[model samples]
Target: MTDSSVDYGAVFKALVAPLLVMTPDFVILAASDSYLKVMGRGQADLLGQDFFAVFPPNPNDPDAIEDYLRASLERVVATGERDFMAVQRYDLEATGRQGVFEDRYWSAINTPVLGPDGEVELIIHRVDEVTDLVQQLGRSGERGVTGARAELETMRTDVYVRARQLLDVNERLKQTTSALQEALDRQRRFVFDASHDLRNPITGLLTELEVALSEPDSDLHPVLRKSLRDAERLNDIVADLLELARLDTATPTTTEPVDLAHLVMDELERRTLTATVLTRLDKQVVVCASRIRLARLLGNLLANAERHTTTTIEIIVTTDPPNAVLEVIDDGPGIAPADRERVFERLFRLDDARRQDPGGSGLGLPIAREIAQAYGGHLYAADHSTGARFVLRLPFAA
Candidate 1:
């Protein structure tokens, strides 16, 4: 089935801001109408030209405007993040006069548009011209310079510094706005997935109960058992969801030094699995973390390995200097190279994962990773020769 999508290029071109879109190599592609109007340039003047060649630094100012702008654009492409520049003084060539420049001040931001391969394919340069305000300050100084020239010059310098400070505050506000938008998008997706997951077992339980109620003389035992299983599944999902929500708050928790090797031994003794388990633990390896949460993290990893491994599971614990490292390796079908990272996303499951363990709550890995990260540690799926391998690293207790 085909899907409908927006023409983002058209939307970008019609944006009501002074925007210049360029290639990664700094070649100008399209200029917004606002940009053309502000710079007094035609489409033919900017399209297909080099960005720097068209808008060179003011030859009059000693400050390196071109260098600053280039560096900002390079950073956007390199880090795939937006770059905001402080208020800058860049002069433009006069419309009809040769070798004459017009003073301009601008607060600029550059953002990257990444392509499918996660490479920066295009950059959108946005500028808000502040020349009028700067020029007004300059004129204010000139008006009072008749008797106190030096004092007024100092006042103008102070006003310029204040203007830059205000610009920085505005940039921070913009960053906050972007962050809130992303958070809202993530929340929306999370709600949708949660609702879908909850609806399934609910529908099944209601259907089975309704059928048994309608048939008074039928064997209700089977219906009750099925309903009970669905209810249990639903409960487990809700519990996992609650655990994830708690982890999301990221509130600081009191911690104590916990022996890692001994804790693993205790947790292993509690579980019964079909696969053979092997352990290679380093004694006296300890870490500072909540013991309950650490057990939950370890439990999730082991449960996941139990669900996927074919015959054998290897548990290793060792100290790598400041870190206490743990590895959980299994002999099941290994994770695909592309899916190692996506496995930790909440509610995410591969086709093989769903078939291997239908009753599994997909939140286990995400919750495990969150728990590790809460303690300033890391958890990730590592490449394995046979099946799946998970590695966890936590700071050794000081």
Candidate 2:
């Protein structure tokens, strides 16, 4: 086709974006002046040659340009599709310049040019080169990485400052705990001293009352006996408080192999609750734990169950490959979901159940849980078929 025959040639040439027309077989039929200049090639040189033969591939691979052209042509012909993008780097052999890396992410529109019978005679290929925009993005990314490094340094400084603050807080906590422990110790010593001093007076009063009761005129014997009972109860409370303080301050000792199954069974037998004891002891379920602490853990659980339940409590001792499981179940009223967790807190008794039973100190379960954790174990309440179930899971012997 002659340039004169095209009515819109001058207008199309005035457009800023590069445009080109090519044969279905990729022969360069025509190109705008901008296309020729951008590509650094002359219209005369490009006119009859295949467009793919005009540029070399990226130096990283020699045949990439040929592959790109073949794929582009196949896509256009097979699907009547357009809008393809690719980044190509090439050496301009005609210019004799070292290869310029061009990121030409181009978008192409393929239109089928039709003859009178509506048969496609040629393809009109139009493209916009977005290399400059892509290069600007690369520069932006380099700046972003530098900014990110500066931000990371700031974060490190913040972390160090926060760490110093936490260390100061921890040291203060240690001091507070030490002072509190000393106060508790003094309180325990006062109770022990008072109890010891009252013992002699209490004994002397009882002896005199016994002597008076033997005489015929003693109506005060009953009053004296009642006073003695009150004194004994007070003494028991004081002793228990002193024991609790000692336990609170005691340091943990080295762990050793303890017969956990035997310890549990002995505690159950002591209560004699008419409950069936199922023991599945793994002959050598030897765990690293303090013996006294383990016994206390087992005893507290057993006693808690016995106190709440009137009839039967079942104790199951089992060992998995890596964990020892102690499950105690009672047919008493199951703990309400809300109170289940709270019941394990120190001095926290639920108003529903423990309030009715006047025997609990409310410290049993919490002590058990503390002991369990000290030996690398955990205690939790679980749902059972008809009762409250407590499970103690401990790490098995290595």
Candidate 3:
């Protein structure tokens, strides 16, 4: 070729993809400008070099570049068809600008070129730079699944730690509640026991003083009698306090049928007071309750009415289908509207005009209420036409 033609060939070679023409024995025939740049060498340095001599085959690995090249040539010659490759990778020498010496895999294609005589004249090699793609795939495969597994482990540990903290807080709350309940129970028992122990001594002293005040010839007899009466009232107050404390401490025992009408009649007969006592009781109104507790409940209400009323104390006992009601109506000055609920509280006395009336410890209604509730009943005060009406309601026996 002329010098002008050769110059044109070199210009064309630089424009093409990395191209190489190889001999049948795998000897280098000619290389393009792009091929020379990949090998990190000049055109003069690669001229006439044996392809396998420059790129040695790894004997321990059978599917090397040299083996692939021989197989392609053999297949093409035997079948009389042009052997072509879609894409592959070839390791090339590193240049100073390449930064490091590493095995570089380049995507490439190889095809057997045929002459007019139908003989395989040369093998054309075309390549592209694909080292970045290969390296990226390798990194993703190495770290993909491991990162996900680490994230899952961290989530599981967080859940377990939070659950343990919640359980610990719950256990502490349970212990605190138990301690508070025990303290309240102990305080209740202490009040009951102390009050019970004081009653006997007070009772004996009042009895002796009453006997001494009965003598008519004594000089200071009237004053002594007044003092004795005051002491007896104080003793009654202490007795009421003791009963209230015991009610607070005591839990309910067995419950059975109680005759409501008989309980009220018995309490009235026991008092034997001359103040007119009236009763209207249902003959067979039975309630499920502790018998002693029910009697005490009725007795407290009757005594309260007797203490407050001037002349007439009326008791009415009635029964409905599901419940029984015992109402004590006293013709005393009625309780104020605002003081109704407060009257059922311990030591809470109404400040009506009848506050001057005598002989009440002010705990009777509260004790009656506690007893009623222990038997699954309720007690309250309702408005009456000209008096105070206290009502006790109990669930009827099944």
Candidate 4:
């Protein structure tokens, strides 16, 4: 399409927030209304301006432009491909009242728009502000780690200073430390579970409220849809927080004879997953486990695969006599060997696609593993050639 055929100015204004449309040479073509609203910039000021000059590279990160935003735009221009940054601390010039540059963190993706000849034309720079999350994690993490380390160091110094006098008390001290460590672990788990449990009811309340507000007969419709958006976001966060809490509690799950193959097929039929399935369990392979819990576990894994990859997901199920082995394999970017273990850690989130996703709780993997453990089964990530492969082994009943 010719440039004159379309009103690019009006089109970009309707696009999402924190967005910028720029030329290959770094000229700002159009900034969305939402972006202008958030960044406190006017269309007149930004139009025809050099993007790099408008929003300079964050001084905090010396390589923000050279290695990041500018470089990403350059790549899109050169190769006509999209580049995503999971999380980056890229500061932006504070406009309007602030009137100074502020420390900002973002999860951004740069995409290219190709011309009729398949050459890159315009670059779409989109970002989600995650400065709050980064700041939160940094503060809590510092306090916890520092406090724990300081306490341990104090204990060590005391032991060292009284090495000779404390010889008899060494055994007692070792016992005390071990007990304290156990109590600390339990306390941490309790705190996590309590917070999550408290959030569950609150989320339920918000969900009901949202539904009430969304009714056709509701009089609050004119209040604007944007006002209730924050409530919905809070509900999502609370739900995710609750998912991980279940793992810390020894809540009883009612077990029954569940046909793994049938249940898997049932779950598969409920949704549309773009994947080729080769079902080997032609016969019913029953498992003695909590049907609800297993369904949740399997559903989480399938949803995870969908979130991580767009390519084919391979599903394999078989019986090894005493145990039934099920594998969910995908052809997306696989997890690193070093990170496989940490991927299951509580509150652990990998990237923009996984953690930053509005629906993700960052508790799916951990909860799934916990459910498996409860059933006397093991769930773990295995070595894969192309993408991620999750294996679940449970005692077979059929």
Candidate 5:
């Protein structure tokens, strides 16, 4: 229809969403019927009134937004441009089932309507309710923090998946370009896993025999009992090897807030450690971590300290923003500066007469570090006066 024949009020009212048209002087010209219904305003009261007059800025708005709409509209009229407002809480009077007045979130855009002489004649107001996304974000704070963040991750994950698919094409074209060291690493991982898998049954056998020995008058062989103890130790080495192998193919770890102090205290209780242990754990410190792996990681540190030190052991848990740190300190000879890197090597053994009594298979540090790295953490050795100090650092869970 021609502009002269068209009923702008009828057309705007027929729209489903809340929208309005206002003259350059900010006088409300027309509003959608739905807009009035949603806003709990009568057309008679709104028409010919300032747009802000009908729905004033909420007194409780944190942004002090009373002047925001007015200022934005002025800018749009002057520049003949479109103004978009960020998602914000804007309290509005209830319409139908809604209460008298409730705080609601909305995204709004103000567009200037120009006249035939290229002067601003009117403003078109379009608003969208975003209360649902805001509520969802508040409830599931761990998910992409906000609605926009959650949506962003979904988009990123899709792009990442597609990019990963491109690797197949690259593989065919760059078959010879594949890194040889990666292939060697894979081969090494396979050997370690294979050996551990084969050794697990021997550990199981020793455990059963130990159980049999527990029963008095069972006439279990003395030689077999000794062998069982040795087998048990070997089983430990194999278990660590298996853990290292698992690290070679670590999966994305799903984490929840874990009480660092509680986990460590519980582990200490289970072991009933003989050494004089001192703990300086902050009860409030927590980390995003896999519960099972967190326990295992702490347990390994305790075991290593206890095995090497005859004196006191100190356990300290602290937080460094973005990371939660657990330190295990013992009163024994500390690691040599040169051997730092070698200690984390799978199946590596320390060369020290004082540290050799445990006769461990050298996989403890490797496995411990493996678990740490799997969860985007780091395990490192540091020199301590009395003995060795090992530090574990993991990211703070959101």
Candidate 6:
């Protein structure tokens, strides 16, 4: 008998395990029948949708599981390896409900499928819904054990499984925290060494240049002036590095209710800009943050806009309910979608930035983001129709 062609797609759909196939970029390609049944979702409703869009993070939960899910999927794509996620609390949109969601607990694993070129093509996401088991266990201590022998045995088995999972989760968290702390320490040491090494040489050069330029009849006036500027730029680089090193290891000493709109207005007023500055300020937007750090954050943003802006720089401050929002927009070459996230990487500069400001230290945006994150906020390059937009979101003051 001739070998028959296999129906792999049908077999995948009919698999006992709940699974979803998504592209590396997280567009849902397909879902298993088990997955559809478990999620209470129609196949048509999920296909061709972005994963995050379909299951947006639960805004009320500060420790959002979507962040972990996204990070795990990204790691799978990057490493071409499977990632087993710790049991997480991710609520699901309720069936037949327009604006309601149900609590969910899930154990998931993401595995990457590689193409012929050995690159990740699609990610296979497998999830096991353990919400019922989790809820039962949470109430076990309060309710006491008043069940049949078989029921109690099953509960005991589940408790063992959950204990093992928690142990694994704690180990992973410990390892990750340790690795991150080590990397941070290394970075801080490097920054300190570089700053210490450069400061004295730069100071000496600047002083010698000033002494030379102070001579009235010097024939090297033009050259000395240029040299002085170069030395000053070097000094600025050392200063920036020191600042970044400090921020990397420091926390805000004092935080108070700061009117965000007034802060932006004050920052704008203090700056001298080549581009026309405009604002749409909401005066009542307030956040609890260090005034000094907020000033530095705003200064970096405006300085960044000034560097790339051709004619107009706009600053907008408004309240977004739970958070106060600030947007700095420039009418210049917008950031490429790929570079938007990379722009916040320390010392990572785009080609346009290099040409626009050759002397830039490239720490401005990174420093700004560090400040934002320290205050339980976020700084990110947002999509804009005309030019580049940088948005800062900080929780509102109590």
Q: Residue 137 deviation, candidate 5, in Å?
A: 63
Model 4 TM-score relative to the real fold = 0.46
Which candidate number maximizes lDDT?
1
For candidate 4, lDDT tens digit of each residue in 95-114?
Answer: 66333567766667888989
For candidate 3, which ten residues in a row score worst on lDDT?
A: 93-102
* Per-model C-alpha RMSD: 7.5, 24.7, 35.1, 22.9, 23.1, 11.2
Model 3: lDDT equals 0.69
lDDT (0-100) at residue 120 of candidate 6?
A: 99
Query: What would you estimate as the lDDT of candidate 4?
Result: 0.72
| TM-score ranking, best first | 1, 6, 3, 5, 4, 2
Tell me how many clashing residue pairs each candidate has. Answer: 0, 0, 0, 0, 2, 0
**Candidate 1 lDDT for residue 376:** 92
Pick the winner on lDDT between candidates 1 and 4.
Answer: 1
Number of colliding residue pairs in model 4: 0
Q: What C-alpha lDDT values do all the predictions have?
A: 0.87, 0.66, 0.69, 0.72, 0.74, 0.83
User: Would you list the clashing residue pairs of candidate 2?
Assistant: none
| Model 6 lDDT, full chain set | 0.83
Over the stretch 59-124, how does candidate 2's per-residue lDDT look in tens digits? Answer: 664434445445556546544545343333332454545565443444445566656965556666
Work out candidate 2's RMSD over C-alphas: 24.7
Q: What stretches of model 4 exceed 4 Å from their correct place? A: 1-246, 274-278, 352-359
Q: After aligning candidate 1 to the native by TM-score, how far in Å is the CA of 394 from where it should be?
A: 0.6
**Predicted candidate 5: what Cα RMSD to the true structure?**
23.1
Compute the lDDT for candidate 5.
0.74
Best-matching candidate per TM-score: 1
Residue 376 of model 2 has an lDDT of 84
